[model samples]
Target: MPQGISTLAADTPTLSAANTGFMLICSALVMIMTPGLAFFYGGMVRVKSTLNMLMMSFISLGIVTILWVVYGFSLAFGTDKGSIIGWSSDYVGLSGIGITQLWDGYTIPVYVFAVFQLMFAIITPALISGALADRVKFTAWALFIALWVTVVYFPVAHWVWGAGGWLFELGVIDFAGGTAVHINAGAAALGVILVIGKRIGFKKDPMRPHSLPLVMLGAGLLWFGWFGFNAGSWLGNDDGVGAVMFVNTQVATAAAMLAWLAYEKIRHGAFTTLGAASGAVAGLVAITPSGGAVSPLGAIAVGAIAGVLCAMAVGLKFRFGYDDSLDVVGVHLVGGVVGSLLVGFFATGGVQSDVKGLLYGGGLDQLGKQAIGVGAVLAYSLVVSALLAFVLDKTIGMRVEEDVEVSGIDQDEHAETAYDFSGAGGGAGSRKAAPAPGDSVAPAAKTKKVDA
Candidate 1:
């Protein structure tokens, strides 16, 4: 071979491995967000459903992992038809993907790429279910996720990420799923909340969280894992990866946290734990799409704006009478929009095979493209998600029996409790029934209620 070709071949393998390694780590980081979501939502809900909320997030770890290996990947990254769904020729467990490759400029194994992307796929829908927490049957949720992934997530993923995807062809830059994951999940959450309705005694009850510590722990894990999320988007361990994403992640989250607290202090008269957790997540969601494209300063602005906007948008649920049980729509949907649109203005020069945004003096031309892209994704996700929910409701039914919901899903659906106070002999957050106010010796069976 010529010296030039020989050198190119020698260099390619090293780059490929690095890309694969980066993506694998990034996938794991994204996976960690599921638990983060569990805690973030867990802390906002009443104590009765805390474990149930955690379980909901945990279950995705199992369900999505399996589906991705089966046909989820093929349905997403395979050949496209009608710019909607993917072909099945690459089906039966990532058959053709690992043999050849779709993405260029990186040498990672295709399976590595699939699994990494798979983690993002797994967690996105799971993030939305927080809005339906504490009420829906576990069985119903499982079925919903299975069906939703096939119908909603896979097609949207294809439209954004697949080879012939319309968005890809249009030169829209998702970088890391602002459109595909966060915005899509947020919109879907809105639809599910509309279908499922609000939690019982939503505003009337105090509905305080059972554990603040768990909320903090979840946030910590999310922050730690985000390094992988932002850096890994580079698709390789190349030289610019560290400086570009690391600062973007750090500053954006910090700006978001401060903005959230500031908003809380102004609106509610104090800084709240729930606000802190929610703000961090909002910052993370906002930065997700813009991280690779924007400068650190731009990220801070994006994070701060997302944090405050989401904090304010939470009030919309109450005003509109939508439950959105845990504000998935408020944070992710709103935050994703903030990031996506801002990238149009703030995206810097020199970070892609091609394309530049407003900051590179490319003007609003890029922003206009971004706006169109966002509209397309939003419209498609909303319509498809509503249809999927409609079908599931008519078929297996969307909710649990009213009795089961009143009783609790942990015992009813899973046949397991998140905590066993009696079994464990008094752990901090154990489940136990409290005596009725009028009872001397269990006077009225119905009067006694369990501690949340």
Candidate 2:
């Protein structure tokens, strides 16, 4: 539904079965991304934390779905209020709308739009779990997801894509969710990590990824699913805009992957698999916003630029002393900003709207609009997410006790380990168990800082 793109205003009343079917497939594709993200983050953490990492991403599927069905759709897509939020009694619980009711202006049914957007709502918070990996208590993390989405994501979504969303009203062009999703999640990741504090041994420990294959698999799934995440934003394929977006998405991602591998080879003396996966995601994020508005060549430039930038940006955590464990801040935050801003330069004025980029001779007008969109989402998400984490930290606590963190958050948090140690054909498979709730403790190594 894209908050504002599909439902802002009603257009042709005639329903198109083809668009409806296309959207349903896109919705399913978007749903696959959450699991893909789980695998990606799951593989990036140390062996001890793999299950906990995967759970963090997976839990959003359960929590956000319930919330979205209840009031998330209304708060985000309902009628506008002061250009800040939305509300519609009918949308609550998704109970009142008829099955045949079409989205305000699109060819698909409202139910289809709601489910599609539900997938977006789910993944946005899941993206934040990467920063807090290996530390946060599952329950506290769950609560944070519930609260953060209600306070931050819902309103911000309304602001960017809602019918009267301030950004939408301002004519800001967010073809997908550079501002709403990537920047929103990235800023929130930065915010929550700052308040929650660093993971133990964040800098000094080698902390290498446990399984690059899993990371690559997750990246592949994310890349494959993103076509739905981007092209489907248009809500219909009646025009060729959706088709253009699909091509650009592929173009940017490939360019970014190559650029990142090139950079890694030059800087680290090898073309690491992590670099390739990260670069691919960086390109996906960059093209997400600009793909619908730019040419294939422009997409290549965008992806290549984002690739190098994010590859360099990932090292910032080591230098700046932030524990963005999975480079969410680097890939998503930086890629989103790069993509959102580039629209002001590469926009061709022929695809999505008449607005042209500076290079296209549209002057700086569109650039200013994009800056406003980027700054607003970044500032709001950072401040508000920090506040949410701080409140949770003070009341119920966010991180687990030091020993649980050191031993493994997986066992303590979920009562299970990701892999069994027993030989392949053994009884009970030597399952590891969680520590008793009030067990004795021993001191482990203290957290440390190191240069990249």
Candidate 3:
């Protein structure tokens, strides 16, 4: 355990009521991030697929919650089996765990700790929905979430955070979840997209986001919730570290947003709302692991670097021919890498841990360790995610039928649409129906002459 943390006897109650309440509030804040993600992803997809995109995120809240309570927690935070995984039955159903019992090194009850971790589990899989967007079968996606968390997320979380976990034992620093959440999900997103293939009209079609306002709303909520996500990782407010993480999270996100806008104006000729929102998320991902270790300026550096790098990275799909619908691979995976690696250069000791980085005269030691952690997690997540996706694709079929996709995934998959245009006097009551994938209207028909 880190220096200040103390292990209490099993029967002792060292719980602080104030800290417990704060953690619960933070858990609720983090819980809102899934819906925020839904809106973020929903706005990026075509109007026809909006509801399906939202549903993909919503279902994770339902599915992962149940699984977490049953056995997910055990596999993630239970007794360590090897350095790779936790014992599957140790904390099964949270059995034998006392509500009043405090987790080691924390003033909050174990139950609060369990529930806070549950929020992390919920949002991690939801992050992948952006990559698969319009083409996946709803059933296949739900199944994927269940299975992916089992094989990929649970083990990886253990490796990063569980007691006796390999990376944790190696003194690898992931304050919140740069490795376990963002990088893991981003790599998994890539694996799924590789197998499921691109959207029907990926590059050829103009697949612009349907609503910028909704995207902004989601981004705002994510920003609001991320304070909890980063700061709450401390598990208690007794120390001043939580405040440091909190400030770092805010400044990093702000710096990243500005960097993204600047990049957009220079590259695309206009500053776009999409760029700003994506930049904010990129910063959030980047700072998640390093916020507690770096100074405010270091946070800015990390965020700004992530913002610029991820902005450029979003174009990689076009160059490489893979379609990451909402730039999940670019922003999350790439941003996570930027933040995790930068810690080796910017970690100032006396903030969270007693460690210094290269710039602080710590030399190449910490930098090399960061590289090892990043490489191990990325390789493991990519391989296992690809295998899982391949098995599902071969057995149950990962995508919807071509007709269903072209017409609309929302109607076919969920029998619902995000926007109802039936009330608009556009002639037909159901004029909101999407155009067929390859359908084209005559130029004359598409053109509407208006009185000037």
Candidate 4:
């Protein structure tokens, strides 16, 4: 639209292409993490509801993709009106936003950027369902995700990444998504947990993972995908920012793993697989905000601190009696806060603004800014998300019928089984299930045998 800024300019093509390519790859990477999330969450719940948990994440691949193309992208990245929300002028319904436009100044297609961002939009809401698992109906959950994205996720995205977002304007540095993804999902998770109430046997039963292997697999996938997520934020391969982020990602995660194992061994007498996975995730969350800003050493500190803090926070659910089923709030929200705040202190090499943090002898100014950003993000996300959740609950009836919930939504809503090796497949919709041994395997074996 401006002179000397042709969408087809040579430099523009390179920069745009890089941005587009990286983001598209990141989007794909993020999508895989949902299944990873399924595994991560599946292992945390009782075997009976594992498929249902996995379904929640998978559904986003369909729902959010459609929504983002239709209106979600416009609301998030379209022309800014008042710095709160976007307009439809940019690219509504995939109009005029072609590959050339995508690499307008970057290296990839604009579609790539949109699609990559779409992956993020889709997964952010899925992160919250863990808290509401084994309770909500699939239809209700679907409706809620659709509504919540419109009300909660979109606005927050606008505030953080959109052209005139308040946080962006305020100089809050989220290299990836400390406030946008982590804090927003974490706070909303707490809201839904309150609305949905605890799982049937949350505290009473020792609900072990249906499959530890699945959990480990999910953790591995998430860790891999996160590289795309964090490094891709740079929007291109520029000045080794991506490499720095890539290395920090591993460093912090490793540090967190060790810290968590150490703490668990000291406190619980076991270095649980769950602890290692959780620690990796915690480290990832903590480094997300400051990955590009801090040194590798700084990342280790962030990771270790996040491990200890998140481990401590997870216990809070039990003490306070809120069922954050998969520790989304503890790990994402608290870890995000830690990273966002700590970056102010540990930042070096002039990676960010002129501001230096307390540890850097810049005193408390930067730290105060970090605190303000955290509070603002937390408050905005919590209030908007709660309101959105309440609205969805009232309009569509958020929770499923008690019987349907108890039976599992895979059968009740989708008439599907995640695993179907045997022919006597699990039946549909809230039927009373006789307690069978080996909850995860028998159904599949019987289904396969029947099929044969």
Candidate 5:
């Protein structure tokens, strides 16, 4: 989630307690993002499917954490091999890594770095859940996550941020996870949705969001946690780079929200709460990759462009006839691209390195690197995710039954509903205790609604 590095600074390698403490806080912030995302996506779906939507994201916190402890960190950040992947015996079970040893000479311990990155790994898959809302089976989704992260996310993280990885060697500056997280997850979402197809009533049904307030709450939490996600990418703030990233993150997110609302007013003639939430997310995504290298002005430009572009991109699903239930493809994929590519034009050459963007007298070199990084992650994620979903669909079935989906997926999948609509007036419709095996209910009695 932080910027990738190949070498240590020339100063002494002594550790700092302050840096270690700062990183731990950042790691916690990043960890909160998964629940934040759950709420955001949960609020977008119909009332009947709210629990499923939330569970889709919340599950990643468990699945990815276990996998990361097992081998995820090693595959992503261990010793280099042929510039394609990484491995180290010490990183295998994390038992070999000493608690006192600093990570690659940074002030934070290896455990802190590994856990911080673990948060990134966890949330990346969670981001994809937004696009597959309402229909997919939870067990299949969990299996897909385990396979996808091992096959796709781990290697891509190596390529983008591991020491001596190809994209890292190419000098593609990903301040945070523009390529490894956003683009990777967004592309995966697109691929899986393509395989699974649309919801029961894609274009015809009234699938309006059930809770705008919850969506807004989630968006606010994401914005707050992102300060840590972006700023902590530097690992420590001794050099003041982290401070700049923090400011840029705020600036870009604000700009993107305003820009999205403006575009909405002109095009749709209304400034909706959904648009505001989506716009803020777009700005956050766009600034993630370029924040450490760009100025506040550049961040504004990045946010505005991403807000407008993503707003327009969301509409493409309707025209092209893909589902993309919550616009993950439109927002994260497009915003990641805008931020990653814009670094070539907006980079000031003073933040992270001496390299300059075109606006700062550098040539088109960085732009080419950014493009390669984007294309590589996009292609790998899309193809692999599609294949994974297809295989699972063929073997275990990804989508629920048509009638189950049309009525409600939560009852069939989770045996639970998000809300209990049966009145609390103690009427006949109120839920009664389940009858014993030998007992029977009256045939004319109405089925009472109760959350199991």
Candidate 6:
């Protein structure tokens, strides 16, 4: 054998068992985020719509997983045909791919890379479900997810991450998915809400969260899983950069939660649990894109800003009469923009990528690039999502009937309820009629009707 050939062969990148294990574990962590999102969204909606909220996120896990293996991965990460999208059928159903083939510049197998990306594809659409919580039809939502991912997500992923992708080539920084995931979903949520219109009673009804505890639990899961969502994007087990991202994620989230509580106390006269949970999510979204590029202090700034901004942005629904069911647009969209743009200012160049922000003396070049990327995604997602919602609304009906929505979406859409209260009355399933206002003899048997 020629010495040059032997030398090249010897230097070829090989799989690292540690990195592979790390990535696989990260994949599982990211996978759990969708269910965490389900619980997060499920708790924010009324009880009547809780199961429906959960189903919306859960269905994405099933649907996107199948689509990803079939063609989604190819379209998103296949050989890039142009800056717009990827084109190559070779990877469809992961055909002709070898188990030993390593991802470019990485130690993990290509299959591991594919599945990790698949988790991202799953959560993007699910994030939008929080916006359309109560009124959407199950069949229509399923169809919408199928079409939206095909048209919007796959192409956008290509534009951001595919080889020779426009944004990637232009040096726009999105460490995780600030633009392709959160901003895209947030803008899409707004567009769909515009088409679907407000819930039956927008500002008139209380429409408070059905279960704050559930929301908190879901938030905790999200925070836990987000370590993978952000740091795992590194696609390796490098202790230096990955550990930096991990610590940044934690500090940013904590800062945002505290900022949110402070804001809540001042604005609403109380520090609410919902504020804490929402604040943490806001911080998570903010740090996802910038964590790799910024220092721990930078992460705190990003988180604090995102927390305050998202808190205020959530009220936009009420002011503008749009009725984002669970503040998806406010938190994800706004926080995403905050994070992505802040990267231009906080990027320290040597830590992650070679880009630096204005504060770091990199000038407005990176910031402008971030803006363009954000605008392009925001416009594309909004227009495309609106058009899709309109077409679905016109043809097969995107929302449930007024009567069904008024009664309950869970019972009508899924034929089941989240909580069964039928067994609450008496022993052996005996019924108990409602007592007159003051007629309760025993406090233990008395039931208080809480407003939904």
Judging by lDDT against the true structure, name the best candidate.
2
Candidates in order: C-alpha RMSD to true structure: 6.6, 7.9, 5.7, 7.1, 4.8, 6.0
What residue pairs clash in candidate 2, if any at all? Answer: 4-161, 10-104, 11-105
lDDT, residue 190, model 6: 96
Question: What are the Cα lDDT values of the candidates?
Answer: 0.77, 0.93, 0.90, 0.79, 0.92, 0.90
RMSD of 2: 7.9
Write the residue-wise lDDT of candidate 4 on 101-220 in tens digits: 643345556777787788789888888877777777787788778878888788878777776777666667778888888888898888777766777768997766768888899999
Question: What is the lDDT for 258 in model 6?
Answer: 93
lDDT of 6 at 402: 95
lDDT tens digits by residue: candidate 5, 1-452: 34444454676466789999999999999988889999999899999899999999999999999998889899999999999899888898897998888898577889999998999999999999999998899999999999999999999999999987999888888989999999999999999999999998799988999999989999988998999899998999799999999999999999999999999999999999999999999999999999988999999999999999999999999999999999999999999999999999999988987778889988999989999999999999999999999999999999988998888889998999998766566766576665699887678856689999
**Candidate 1 to truth, TM:** 0.87
Cα lDDT for residue 148, candidate 1: 80
Question: In model 2, where do residues sit more than 4 Å from their true spots?
Answer: 1-11, 425-452
Instruction: Report the C-alpha lDDT of model 2 over 1-452, residue by residue, as the tens digit.
Output: 23344433344566789999999999999999999999999999999999999999999999999999899999998999999999999999999999999887777899998998999999999999998888999999999999999999999989988999899999888888999999999999999999988988888888899999999999999999999999999999988989999999999999999999999999999998988899999999999999988999999999999999999999999899999989999999999999999999999988888889999999999999999999999999999999999999999999999999999988998999998755555455235354599987677568688889
Superposed Cα deviation of residue 237, candidate 4 (Å): 0.5
lDDT of 6 by residue, 228-296 (tens): 888888888654788889999999999999998899899999999999999999999999888989999
Model 1 backbone overlap count: 2
Query: Where is the poorest 10-residue window by lDDT in model 1?
Result: 1-10
CA shift of 78, model 2, Å: 0.3
lDDT of 4 at 104: 34
Candidate 1 C-alpha error for residue 395, in Å: 2.8
To one decimal, what is the Cα RMSD in angstroms of model 1 from the true structure?
6.6
What tens digits encode model 3's per-residue C-alpha lDDT throughout 312-373?
99999999999999999999999999899998999998799879999888898888988888
